[model samples]
Target: MNNFFPAVLRLIAKLVILAIAVIAVAVIVFWTPGKPADELAERWATPPSLFMDLHGMQVHIRDEGPRNDPEPVILLHGTSASLHTWEGWAEHLAQHRRVIRMDLPGFGLTGPHPREDYHITAYSEFVIALADSLQIDKFVLAGNSLGGRIAWTTAAVAPERVTRLILVDPSGGYPLPPKSMPLAFHVAQLPVLGQLMDYMLPRFMVRNSLENVYANPDLVTDELVDLYYDMARREGNRQALRQRFQQDDNGHEQAIIRSLEQPTLILWGAQDRLIPVANGYEYARDVRNSELVVFPDLGHIPQEEDPDQSLQPVLNFLGLAEQR
Candidate 1:
């Protein structure tokens, strides 16, 4: 018994040391701040044409279209996505109505806000502040996936400001959870290993993510990979994305969707393994005077996947095109 006591004591000491090391590692990782968003923003550095201002933090947004256009549309992208998601749609829509798209804090070149929560309500406030800054009274709002969730919430809370609502595979409001959520979601859900992702993101990680969302892998060009990979390296962007994934707003937001009053158009990829097609129907039922359009071969992003087929339905809903 006396001999066994010495062995047990050695094991206890080893475990105590190991525990301290683990905690120390966690504290350092969590508290350590990251670099600025410049590296991430480099590939996206085009001819200077963005407006940056501190609305809590510096926001990067593109406001286009003729000043005289009455009905404007604000576009929002999904998780780990940037304002460029609407590049194709923006080129077309800006000609007709005022089109505004942005890199939401944490995801794109805009980076994360100083605020810790990054809640839906926090984002709702930022959008309103932007409208006030632009001196606009009311306009149409559209978003894909996570952005779509915010669009619905913004309309519900501030219906007076939102003229029309458009959603593409938006999360949070719909009952059906994402079918094959990104690998980041599972990692971000973990306690320890997930924290490592925010700090050290490989270029391949970005490539894998792009391929996963895209319906056709061949469509993901080297340039596209470079853009996404570089943008993710921006100082605060990765951490913001990490935290955004960790924050769960699922249960609290169904009531927000129920409160929506504005006319809405729900567009989805029928082959979307990310957020299932059931969400399109769920949103269509919730909003007043809503319509749902599902593309057979499209995945998560119908706008990017098949714009020619997708845009016609959207234009039809907005009454921008003459009825057939």
Candidate 2:
């Protein structure tokens, strides 16, 4: 019996070593770096794409429509989403309003911020600087998820500059965890496991995240997943995301929301799984003069899921119905 136990132990050790070897080989075969901004710009960067030096970083922005529009509209996307997420909205709003969207630092072609600061304060400052550089004295600010949080904070900081505020499933107001989170976000928040993603990321992972955020999984296309996958590989982006998740402390959300006095429009997807639809009610309750519109069929990104339907309320709220 003792000899049999020794032999079994030896066999288990061999199996463990073999498994390790296989995993190492897989990692080596799939190892990859994020696509360069220049390379991604070739395919993703379309007409009207402009790059500007802001805070010593190259920012990718699209300034569309009539420049003379009284109050220009600035749109900000959610985490892991690029300025491209606003493409549908930009197409419609640009007719009568100058719509501007940019890839935030640590995302898309903009790459990562040198300072590695992804806090709300830093993001709000970035928005102000971008507006100042563009000489936009006053503008309408709208954002989704993280961008939404930044938008309200910006309005609180410079109330006079932001004529109107729009929040689309914006984060903050409530700290309750979602029913389920995107696997990629959960992995990125891990310690050692997150670092492995920097070396190798499968395209399927991107697809899964897109699927998770969209109300309809069919909306997740191969090309859309490619854009997300490639941009994630952008040098320094993965690390920047890790830092942002690790360092972000959303304790001051209540104070920020309570202090907001701007005319706010809160849009949310009733099917939103990331930041539950309940938070939408919380936002409307806190913001004194705010309107909340919930899309029964949409998920986290209603604007992208169904822009035509989602943007109608925004137009009405912004008093741009005449232009429509």
Candidate 3:
């Protein structure tokens, strides 16, 4: 035993030195700033359309509804997505009920804050704070993927504010990444490699990512591509995404969703490439009153790609089908 002790100590010292070198390199790479895309400036020239003071930062949101509408509805988008995910639903829902959608911190126009916490609880607090700023007390909550996880967490923490729950391909009960994925996701996970990739922001990379998300890649238009590219180039967004990916919540959301008893709607693209369709059933079985709606032949983003079919089910779930 004594003969081997010296060798073990030497190995430990070598490992420590290697770890320090790796960390030092990471720090240097992380500190360097990325050059913003040129055409991006033309597109994102304006400040966000809606900015509400929340947790010491300006939150960007889109609010729509008639003046007298009573039930306020909030929409949360998935990872790497902004309020645009709810564009079709918001446009239709705003007619009857007050609809509010925001870019969760680290995404879209709002980007990141001074504090870089992106855990579900942190996001939940921001959701409530946004609702407070808009004077919304009770509302239906709908979220997709990561957004779905945040919505459920908010309802579990503050049940009074969330009366109904809608989870479109929500992620928590399962542990599989959807087959169809966005490029931003992989790039954001690397410590400094992501920053370097962002600086190289190849237009083809953006197009390929958009192509992968939809069942029909042709759906990606020039103007819409510009929106995503421009917003991605905004100074703090890439860094914010990196910080958010590092945030962790100790799997408490699974138990909370299983105990959920709200009038819940679970919508999924049967062919969802990201987050998969099985996740829909996992939550359906957990939530006693949840209904699962699956759309065949669609990819990850059912709301954005197939709004006509997607909005109908969401409207029915909210009981706004007849009103609109």
Candidate 4:
């Protein structure tokens, strides 16, 4: 009996070693290195894409529609997302209003901030600086998720510059934890895994993150995966993401949000597991001049998930519904 037990232990040890080997092989095979922003820009940056020198960074921006429009719309994207998230809305909105979207520093073709400062304040300042560079005095500011937080912060700090605010599932209203966080975000919070992410990222990780945010997983196409994966792998972006997450304050600036004076439009995805619909209610309650709209069928990104449906409320708010 003693001999049999020893043999079984040996077999178990061998099986464990084999499993480890398999995992190591998979890791090596799928090892993804970061790509230079120039390489990614070829596929992502098209005609409207302008690489302007803003605050010492070659900011990748798309300025469309009639430049004569007095009040243009500036669209900002969420964490790990580029301006492309606003493509559907921007395309339609550009027909009437001047529409501008950019890859915020630490994401997309814009790459990372030279200072590596990813605080909400830094982002707010960047928005103001971008406006100055564009020579735009005042406009409607709209953002989603992290971008939404920046949008409101900018309005609070520079109230005169923002005529209207559209916050979609913004993260700065309440200090509520997500019911279900994306695997990538979870890893980014871990010391070890987050560091490893800087060097090696798997395609599945990007795909899973996108699927997690969308109400419909099927909408996450291979092309969509390619865009996200490519942007995530941009040089210095992964590290910037890590820095941003580290510096993130989960709604410590509720005072700033409550202080917003611009006419605000709050949009939330009812199916959002990241930031619940309750936060949306809090925004409507806190912001004196705000309207809240919840999309029952959408998740974290209602604008991206259903731009047509989500844009209707925004159009009405902008008084462009009659034009439609």
Candidate 5:
């Protein structure tokens, strides 16, 4: 019996060592750091894509549709997302109204902010600067997730400039942290594990994060994953995200929502595990002129998940829809 126990223990130790060795090899094979912004821009930034020097950073922006249309709509993408996220919406909306979208600092091809500022207020200011640079006096603002938070804040600070607001699962006023977050995001929140992400990122991790946020798991295709993965590896992008995660949460949620007087549309995914649909109701109640639309089968990013279905209500709200 004593000999049997010793033999089993030795076998277990060998198996453990072999497992560790396999993992080490896998890490070495997949330790891809990603391409620089210049290289990615070659493929990602095609025609109609323009880079403007704003706040000392080269901002990637796309202005589409009718330039003469007043109150041009400015679309803001969420954390880790690029202007391409609005491609579907911009395509349709641009037909009637001028549509503008940009890759925010620390995300997409914009990489990181020179000042290393990722706060909501900083984003708000960046929006204003972008608007000023474009000579836009008044415009309609729409955003999803982190972009939504910036939209509302900009309205509060410069109500005269933001004629209306569209918030799609905004983040500033989350009653609580998301029920579930992407594993990469969870890792980024950690003190030590986050450092490892700065140096190494696995394509599977990006794929996993995309799948988690989407209502349909199958939407996380290879091309989609490649877009996110390449952008994340863009120099300084990962580090900027880490800084953003570490920043203090902006408080006074109710007050911020209450202060909004612009006609508002609150869009949410009922199945959103990130920011629950309940938040859409709270936003509707607080904003006197606001209307909430919840997608029963959608997740956090209904806009991207099903743009055709999600954008119809927005078109109606903006009075841009063709009358039947």
Candidate 6:
């Protein structure tokens, strides 16, 4: 019996050593340090990309199209996504209407908010402040995922600023958990794992998250992964991501959805597993003036997956379809 106890202790010690070795190897393999926004700007922030002082951060933004348009179209990308996500849509939309898209406080080159307040209310307020800074009286607000929630919230809080609403797989209408959350997002919500992520991030993690949101994993190219990976590595973004997940109330203020008076267009990926297409129906049912469109083959980020197909409805909604 004494020998048996000694053997067990020896085994336990060996296992502890093995665990430490494994962690050391992982740290060596995935030891990605945060990069200053200036370091990444040379490559990611080219022409048309400018940083403007707003809301206590140098906001990364792209403003395109005719300046005379009274009510421009403002596009907001989802969590973990930068303004690049809307590039395909922006390229085309800017041809006709003024399209403004930015890297929200927690993501992209904007880094983390000084106050570290990632509540949906803070995001909505930031949008309003951005509009005011641009001297825009009214705008057609369009957003996807978390950005969708912010868009609707902005409309609810500052109805006078939002002339129309376009929600693409927005994160609201019932607080139900995602069918399949991305590995990175899941990690960001965990205490230990999220803290570790602030220091070491693997390229594959970013790629896996992209593949999770994309219906066709093949569409997740190395270039796409590089962009997302680089953006995530922006100094303070990792910590901000963790804060965002913690602050997320999962659409607690969604009751205001029913009270939205602006014309609404709802878009969803029929194949979306993250938020599910059913939420699209919920938005349509609650918002009195809303239309829902679902794409059979796309996933959570239909706009990025298939911009051409996803943008047709938006064009029609904006009365620019005939022009195309």
Candidate number achieving the greatest lDDT relative to the actual structure: 6
Kindly give the number of clashing pairs for every candidate: 7, 2, 5, 0, 0, 0
- Model 5 misses residue 276 by how many Å? 0.6
Comparing 1 with 5 on TM-score, the higher-scoring candidate is 5
lDDT-sorted candidate list, best first: 6, 4, 2, 5, 3, 1
Residue lDDT tens for model 1, 148-184: 8888888888989998888887887656666676665
Which segments of model 4 are wrong by more than 4 Å? 1-26
TM-score of each: 0.85, 0.94, 0.83, 0.93, 0.91, 0.97
Worst 10 residues of 5 by lDDT: 26-35
- Compared with the true structure, the alpha-carbon lDDT of candidate 1 equals 0.76
| Candidate 5 residue spans exceeding 4 A from truth | 1-27
- Better candidate number, 5 or 6, judged by lDDT: 6
Worst 10 residues of 4 by lDDT: 249-258
Badly placed stretches (over 4 Å) of model 2 are 1-19
Could you tell me the TM-score of candidate 6? 0.97
CA lDDT of 54 in candidate 3?
80
Off by over 4 Å in 6: 3-6
Candidate 5, 1-324: lDDT as tens digits: 869999999999999999889867766876767578889999889989999999888888999988797799999999889998898898899888999999998899988899999988899999999999999999999999999999999999999999999999998775676878998898788886687688778888899999999988998789988888888988898899999988747776788779999999999999888888888888999999899998998888888889898998999999978831
Query: Per-residue lDDT for 1-324 in model 3, tens only?
Result: 887999999999999999889866755654434434233434443332456778776667677787566668889998777888788888788888888888788877677766778877789888888888778788899998789888888888888778999888777766665676677677777766676654546556667777777878888998778677666666688777777777755364567877777899988888777778887888888889888988987777788888889889888887778876
Task: Write one digit per residue (lDDT tens) for candidate 4, span 1-324.
Answer: 869999999999999999889867866877778898888888999888999898779999999999999989999999999999999899899999999999999999999999898998999999999999899999999999999999998999999999999999998768888988888898888997788788788888999999999989999999999999999999999899999999987656678777889999999999999999999999999999999999999999988889899999999999999888
Model 3 CA deviation exceeding 4 Å by range: 1-48, 250-252
Q: What C-alpha root-mean-square deviation, in Å, does candidate 2 show against the real structure?
A: 2.0
